[model samples]
Target: MHEKKYLILYSTQEGQTYKIAQYMAQELGESHCNLINLHEAHTVDFGLYHTLIIGASIRYGRFNKKLYRFIDRHLAQLNAADAYFYSVNLTARKEGKDTPEGSVYIQTFLKKSPWKPKKIGVFAGALLYPRYSWFDRMMIQLIMRMTKGETDTSKEVEYTNWEKVTQFTKSIEKSL
Candidate 1:
């Protein structure tokens, strides 16, 4: 029997999504998983992997356009493989918004995309104030204020739930 090969692809703005992908790769064993940035990958042979996982972050209420393009180009391969998707967004920091049904971005992606993932996860993203430009910081602060989130831009805050992530990873392992 051949060892299962996994491909983990991510599209991130502030790198939280990629960080999550890296964590999953580490948990799944580096040798068994291949991590690729959707923006950087010029070509992807999706058929080479037994499982495919995509992690994408929302920026200004949208996933990257490249993500949709990749899905459109490889719709057949995605549907053929044991594929999963996870969306990362600041809105997920809220109590009820940390789920697939509660995540507007995930729901929108599922509705717009031709390929439906076999499983889905929703994770909260980080807020890195220092990494952002002055304009971005202000915009994010405003959004945070409106949502009753952490509005202090002096420090970086991570909202991801590692326990949930571990659970998601275990679920993936169990499915195989």
Candidate 2:
């Protein structure tokens, strides 16, 4: 029997979403899943894959505009397929804000688009101080302080919970 093909595509700014996509692809295995960055992929033949997992990182409380446009442009094909969408953001790492805020973000995006993915995930993002510009770094630091998140800007921090990500992926696999 031929193995089913899955496409894991993501849009990342500071590389956290990319890392999560990589982890999902790795866990799903290269033989069954092909991981691609939205920036690197010019065209996607939706009919060629059995399932598609689209991911995007949140910046300024919204998803990447490019990702939103891609989904909007390919809504028909994506809706016809076994599709899943995951949104990653710093708020998703917070104790009480992750699920609700993530849901709101997804719902707002879906309201503007036509496609409704079968599964949705909200994963925690990271704070890469080293990767941010001086202005962004200071702004994020201030936001973190306001939100009672990690205040020390001297070190890079990752707030993602790998176990939750793995469990979510496994659930999707089973459903498929």
Candidate 3:
């Protein structure tokens, strides 16, 4: 039997979303997967892949505009394939917010977008205060403070649960 082709696309600002995509790619075997950055991708031929996984980070309570545009442009192709979607956000670090139903961003995305994936994931992202610009750092710090999260600008914290990620990847593998 021929090897199944997988398309992994990611839209990341602080790179956490890309990190999750990389983990999935590695778990699925890099040779069988084509990982593309949505920000840099000009066009996508969804027909070339048997499965499509699109991951995007939530920035200031929204997904990247490019992700929406891409989905709008290729909604039919996505719906035809075994498509999966995952959202990365710090809010997911909180209890009861790590599922699609609990994640407001994911819910908003589903309601606002035309395409719905067969599987959905919600993962926690990192907070690198030192990596952000002054304005962003202050804004994120304020949000963190309100949420009772780590607000130290000098520290970088990663909140992703690798075991959950592995489980998600394994689910995809089983589907294939």
**Local distance difference test scores for all models:** 0.91, 0.84, 0.92
TM-score for each predicted model, relative to the true structure: 0.97, 0.93, 0.98
**Candidate numbers, best lDDT first, in rank order:** 3, 1, 2
Candidate 3 lDDT, 108-165, residue by residue in tens: 9989999989999899999999999999999999999999999999999999998999
Candidate 1 residue lDDT tens string, 57-80: 999999999999999888888898
Name the weakest run of 10 consecutive residues (lDDT summed) in model 2.
Answer: 94-103
Model 1: lDDT of residue 158: 96
Colliding pairs, model 3: none
Off by over 4 Å in 2: 100-102
Q: Candidate 1: TM-score?
A: 0.97
Alpha-carbon deviation at 126 in model 1, angstroms: 0.4
- In angstroms, the error of model 1 at 79 is 0.7
- Which of candidates 2 and 3 is the stronger one according to lDDT? 3
For candidate 2, give the lDDT of residue 140: 90
Model 2, residue 4: C-alpha shift (Å): 1.5
**Which consecutive 10 residues in model 3 have the weakest lDDT in total?**
39-48
- Cα error, candidate 2, residue 29 (Å): 1.2
